[model samples]
Target: MNPASHGLKITEQDGVSRIDFVERNILDEANIQQIGESIGAVVDASPRPRLLICFENVEHLSSAALGALITVNTKVKARDGQLRLSNIRPQILEVFRITRLDRLFVIHGTAEEAMDTFG
Candidate 1:
Protein backbone atom coordinates (compact mmCIF):
# COMPACT_ATOMS: atom_id res chain seq x y z
CA MET A 1 0.00 0.00 0.00
CA ASN A 2 1.12 3.49 -0.75
CA PRO A 3 1.86 5.38 2.45
CA ALA A 4 0.76 8.77 1.16
CA SER A 5 -2.69 7.50 0.29
CA HIS A 6 -3.30 6.63 3.89
CA GLY A 7 -1.67 9.83 5.12
CA LEU A 8 1.44 8.12 6.34
CA LYS A 9 4.10 10.71 6.79
CA ILE A 10 7.65 9.61 7.43
CA THR A 11 10.08 12.38 8.21
CA GLU A 12 13.17 13.18 10.18
CA GLN A 13 13.46 15.63 13.03
CA ASP A 14 16.80 16.51 14.57
CA GLY A 15 18.19 13.13 13.47
CA VAL A 16 15.16 11.30 14.79
CA SER A 17 13.08 9.62 12.10
CA ARG A 18 9.40 9.87 12.86
CA ILE A 19 7.40 7.27 10.95
CA ASP A 20 3.73 8.12 10.99
CA PHE A 21 2.39 4.86 9.61
CA VAL A 22 -1.24 4.72 8.61
CA GLU A 23 -3.26 1.71 9.71
CA ARG A 24 -2.62 -1.03 7.19
CA ASN A 25 -2.09 -4.75 7.19
CA ILE A 26 1.63 -4.83 7.82
CA LEU A 27 1.55 -8.57 8.47
CA ASP A 28 3.21 -9.70 5.29
CA GLU A 29 6.87 -10.10 4.51
CA ALA A 30 6.85 -7.66 1.59
CA ASN A 31 5.37 -4.90 3.66
CA ILE A 32 7.82 -5.64 6.42
CA GLN A 33 10.77 -5.58 4.06
CA GLN A 34 9.52 -2.36 2.52
CA ILE A 35 9.30 -0.62 5.85
CA GLY A 36 12.66 -1.93 6.99
CA GLU A 37 14.43 -1.09 3.76
CA SER A 38 13.08 2.43 3.78
CA ILE A 39 14.32 3.07 7.28
CA GLY A 40 17.56 1.31 6.55
CA ALA A 41 18.12 3.62 3.61
CA VAL A 42 17.62 6.60 5.83
CA VAL A 43 20.08 5.23 8.34
CA ASP A 44 22.63 4.67 5.65
CA ALA A 45 22.21 8.24 4.43
CA SER A 46 22.80 9.89 7.76
CA PRO A 47 25.71 10.53 10.08
CA ARG A 48 23.43 11.26 13.02
CA PRO A 49 24.14 10.08 16.52
CA ARG A 50 20.79 8.35 16.97
CA LEU A 51 17.73 6.99 15.12
CA LEU A 52 14.36 7.35 16.73
CA ILE A 53 11.05 5.96 15.42
CA CYS A 54 7.94 7.82 16.46
CA PHE A 55 5.06 5.55 15.53
CA GLU A 56 2.14 7.92 15.32
CA ASN A 57 -0.63 6.33 13.28
CA VAL A 58 0.26 2.69 13.61
CA GLU A 59 -2.26 0.94 15.79
CA HIS A 60 -0.76 -2.52 15.49
CA LEU A 61 2.64 -3.82 14.54
CA SER A 62 3.39 -7.22 13.16
CA SER A 63 6.36 -9.19 14.43
CA ALA A 64 8.00 -8.18 11.22
CA ALA A 65 7.97 -4.63 12.39
CA LEU A 66 9.48 -5.69 15.65
CA GLY A 67 12.23 -7.54 13.83
CA ALA A 68 12.95 -4.51 11.71
CA LEU A 69 13.27 -2.47 14.86
CA ILE A 70 15.73 -4.93 16.32
CA THR A 71 17.72 -4.83 13.13
CA VAL A 72 17.81 -1.07 13.23
CA ASN A 73 18.74 -1.09 16.86
CA THR A 74 21.60 -3.45 16.23
CA LYS A 75 22.76 -1.48 13.22
CA VAL A 76 22.62 1.79 15.10
CA LYS A 77 24.45 0.35 18.05
CA ALA A 78 27.14 -0.95 15.74
CA ARG A 79 27.73 2.65 14.74
CA ASP A 80 27.78 3.77 18.36
CA GLY A 81 24.30 5.27 18.09
CA GLN A 82 20.92 4.46 19.57
CA LEU A 83 17.58 3.50 18.03
CA ARG A 84 14.55 4.65 19.97
CA LEU A 85 10.79 4.30 19.68
CA SER A 86 7.94 6.60 20.68
CA ASN A 87 4.26 7.38 20.12
CA ILE A 88 3.21 3.74 20.36
CA ARG A 89 -0.43 2.71 20.32
CA PRO A 90 -1.58 1.14 23.57
CA GLN A 91 -2.45 -2.16 21.89
CA ILE A 92 0.86 -2.25 20.12
CA LEU A 93 2.53 -1.30 23.37
CA GLU A 94 0.99 -4.43 24.85
CA VAL A 95 2.71 -6.50 22.19
CA PHE A 96 6.01 -4.87 23.05
CA ARG A 97 5.35 -5.46 26.72
CA ILE A 98 4.49 -9.12 26.17
CA THR A 99 7.62 -9.59 24.13
CA ARG A 100 9.76 -7.52 26.50
CA LEU A 101 10.57 -5.04 23.75
CA ASP A 102 9.24 -2.27 25.88
CA ARG A 103 12.30 -2.82 28.01
CA LEU A 104 14.43 -3.29 24.94
CA PHE A 105 13.42 -0.01 23.33
CA VAL A 106 13.23 3.46 24.76
CA ILE A 107 9.51 4.08 24.40
CA HIS A 108 7.76 7.37 25.13
CA GLY A 109 4.27 8.80 24.91
CA THR A 110 5.13 11.42 22.39
CA ALA A 111 7.90 12.38 20.04
CA GLU A 112 8.44 15.64 21.88
CA GLU A 113 8.84 13.79 25.15
CA ALA A 114 11.21 11.34 23.50
CA MET A 115 13.37 14.09 22.11
CA ASP A 116 13.45 15.75 25.49
CA THR A 117 14.59 12.56 27.12
CA PHE A 118 17.23 11.93 24.50
CA GLY A 119 18.44 15.49 24.51
Candidate 2:
Protein backbone atom coordinates (compact mmCIF):
# COMPACT_ATOMS: atom_id res chain seq x y z
CA MET A 1 0.00 0.00 0.00
CA ASN A 2 1.01 3.59 -0.56
CA PRO A 3 1.03 4.73 3.04
CA ALA A 4 2.46 8.07 1.98
CA SER A 5 -0.99 8.98 0.72
CA HIS A 6 -2.07 8.88 4.33
CA GLY A 7 0.91 10.86 5.66
CA LEU A 8 3.28 7.95 6.19
CA LYS A 9 6.23 6.57 4.28
CA ILE A 10 6.63 2.81 4.38
CA THR A 11 9.31 0.38 3.37
CA GLU A 12 9.64 -3.32 3.89
CA GLN A 13 12.68 -5.55 4.11
CA ASP A 14 13.34 -9.01 5.49
CA GLY A 15 9.68 -9.46 6.39
CA VAL A 16 9.61 -6.30 8.50
CA SER A 17 7.63 -3.19 7.70
CA ARG A 18 9.06 0.20 8.57
CA ILE A 19 6.89 3.27 8.78
CA ASP A 20 8.06 6.87 8.88
CA PHE A 21 5.78 9.79 9.59
CA VAL A 22 5.60 12.46 6.91
CA GLU A 23 4.52 15.14 9.35
CA ARG A 24 6.74 16.98 11.80
CA ASN A 25 3.98 17.40 14.36
CA ILE A 26 1.44 14.64 15.00
CA LEU A 27 -0.95 16.77 17.00
CA ASP A 28 -4.02 16.84 14.89
CA GLU A 29 -6.77 14.45 15.94
CA ALA A 30 -7.80 13.64 12.40
CA ASN A 31 -4.27 13.03 11.31
CA ILE A 32 -3.63 10.82 14.29
CA GLN A 33 -6.69 8.76 13.42
CA GLN A 34 -5.47 8.33 9.88
CA ILE A 35 -2.05 7.30 11.08
CA GLY A 36 -3.55 4.74 13.41
CA GLU A 37 -5.57 3.30 10.58
CA SER A 38 -2.63 3.23 8.23
CA ILE A 39 -0.44 1.38 10.69
CA GLY A 40 -3.28 -0.84 11.69
CA ALA A 41 -3.69 -1.90 8.08
CA VAL A 42 -0.05 -2.83 7.89
CA VAL A 43 -0.43 -4.88 11.02
CA ASP A 44 -3.46 -6.66 9.68
CA ALA A 45 -1.75 -7.56 6.45
CA SER A 46 0.88 -9.67 8.15
CA PRO A 47 0.38 -12.91 9.98
CA ARG A 48 3.11 -12.07 12.43
CA PRO A 49 3.75 -8.42 11.79
CA ARG A 50 7.11 -6.87 12.48
CA LEU A 51 6.74 -3.11 12.46
CA LEU A 52 9.20 -0.32 13.14
CA ILE A 53 7.85 3.18 13.45
CA CYS A 54 10.50 5.85 13.01
CA PHE A 55 9.91 9.24 14.57
CA GLU A 56 12.68 11.02 12.72
CA ASN A 57 10.34 13.66 11.33
CA VAL A 58 8.14 14.17 14.33
CA GLU A 59 8.96 17.12 16.60
CA HIS A 60 5.75 17.17 18.61
CA LEU A 61 2.79 14.93 19.28
CA SER A 62 -0.36 15.22 21.31
CA SER A 63 -1.66 12.95 24.03
CA ALA A 64 -4.19 11.65 21.55
CA ALA A 65 -1.32 10.60 19.34
CA LEU A 66 0.06 8.61 22.26
CA GLY A 67 -3.30 6.93 22.66
CA ALA A 68 -3.28 6.01 19.00
CA LEU A 69 0.15 4.45 19.38
CA ILE A 70 -1.02 2.48 22.37
CA THR A 71 -3.88 1.22 20.31
CA VAL A 72 -1.52 0.16 17.58
CA ASN A 73 0.63 -1.62 20.13
CA THR A 74 -2.36 -3.47 21.42
CA LYS A 75 -3.29 -4.59 17.95
CA VAL A 76 0.22 -5.78 17.29
CA LYS A 77 0.35 -7.77 20.49
CA ALA A 78 -3.02 -9.29 19.83
CA ARG A 79 -1.64 -10.71 16.60
CA ASP A 80 1.54 -11.88 18.31
CA GLY A 81 3.38 -9.24 16.28
CA GLN A 82 6.34 -7.07 17.23
CA LEU A 83 6.43 -3.29 17.22
CA ARG A 84 9.43 -1.04 17.71
CA LEU A 85 9.64 2.72 17.92
CA SER A 86 12.78 4.55 16.81
CA ASN A 87 14.39 7.90 16.10
CA ILE A 88 12.38 9.62 18.80
CA ARG A 89 13.73 13.02 19.74
CA PRO A 90 14.72 13.69 23.35
CA GLN A 91 11.74 15.90 24.11
CA ILE A 92 9.36 13.31 22.75
CA LEU A 93 11.25 10.57 24.51
CA GLU A 94 10.84 12.52 27.72
CA VAL A 95 7.11 12.55 27.21
CA PHE A 96 7.12 8.79 26.69
CA ARG A 97 9.18 8.40 29.84
CA ILE A 98 6.86 10.65 31.83
CA THR A 99 3.93 8.59 30.68
CA ARG A 100 5.82 5.38 31.42
CA LEU A 101 5.18 4.31 27.85
CA ASP A 102 8.90 3.95 27.40
CA ARG A 103 8.55 0.69 29.29
CA LEU A 104 5.52 -0.38 27.31
CA PHE A 105 7.45 -0.12 24.05
CA VAL A 106 10.82 -1.27 22.83
CA ILE A 107 12.49 1.96 21.73
CA HIS A 108 15.74 2.47 19.86
CA GLY A 109 18.04 5.35 18.97
CA THR A 110 17.98 4.60 15.26
CA ALA A 111 15.91 2.66 12.72
CA GLU A 112 18.88 0.47 11.91
CA GLU A 113 19.24 -0.42 15.58
CA ALA A 114 15.58 -1.20 15.81
CA MET A 115 15.69 -3.33 12.70
CA ASP A 116 18.54 -5.34 14.18
CA THR A 117 16.29 -6.23 17.10
CA PHE A 118 13.55 -7.48 14.80
CA GLY A 119 15.47 -10.69 14.38
Cα-lDDT of candidate 1: 0.72
Q: Could you give me the TM-score of model 2 versus the true structure?
A: 0.95
Which portions of model 2 show Cα errors greater than 4 Å? 1-5
Which regions in candidate 1 have their CA more than 4 angstroms from the true location? 1-8
lDDT tens digits, residue span 13-119, model 1: 77676666654445667767777776776666667546667777676678987997888777766766667788887888899999998887888888788777654
Best by TM-score: 2
**Deviation (Å) of 55 in candidate 1:** 1.7
**Model 1 residue-pair collision total:** 0
